[model samples]
Target: MVVLVLTACPAGLRGHLTRWLLEVSPGVFVGQISARVRDLMWARVLELSKDGRAIMVFHADTEQGLAFRVHRHDWQVVDVDGLSLMLRPHEVGGQSELRPGWSSVARARRARRRK
Candidate 1:
């Protein structure tokens, strides 16, 4: 199985993809094709996608049974402990200033509970 997601790409590139894959939704394509064909399509996408971004996920023999490739995307793919992960782009600092589950309301509730 193969999944191709495109963002801000040209119509020509999308049209070229539709020839081999099914457009499950706007900018999302899914299909199963030979590796050679998939590579060829990816090449065409790179040639025609211009400044657009694309990500392709496909079956593989890896531990997760899948692999992915990204082009001109902010997010990055990383490998850790033999697992593939998506790494979000961080701010200028090494960590993000904003933290999850630390909303003001939550903080107020915590303060009341401590009292």
Candidate 2:
């Protein structure tokens, strides 16, 4: 088994890429999909890119089953034979700062430091 980490700068694109890969390869791959998907995911991502969307994909190899963590959330088990896992922003800790009032706390901390 292998672990792959995929990330997209923009949140919307991430979901779009993820869905596209799933549609193309089904359970064959897992983890976030982005503009890099084409080169990283190889032919499969290329087929999905025909629709035209910037995507990125990363591949990592693991000896055992792949586990995903995004935004502190554990992803649902996706049974695929290869060594890859797709992760959404929220699933991989990318959305950790998106919580309600997080910005306010950060601002307050910054203000305190400045003082």
Candidate of highest TM-score:
1
Q: Which number leads on lDDT?
A: 1
lDDT of each: 0.91, 0.42
Candidate 1 Cα deviation (angstroms), residue 81: 1.6
lDDT of 2 by residue, 77-106 (tens): 344675445533463345563654468887
lDDT of 1 by residue, 68-97 (tens): 899999889999998888888775366675
Deviation in angstroms for 97 in model 1?
Answer: 7.1
User: Candidate 1 has what TM-score?
Assistant: 0.81
Q: After best superposition, candidate 1 residue 69: deviation in angstroms?
A: 0.4
lDDT of 1 at 2: 95
For each candidate in turn, the TM-score is: 0.81, 0.24
Candidate 2, position 36, lDDT: 51
Total clashes for model 2: 26
lDDT score for residue 32 of model 1? 90
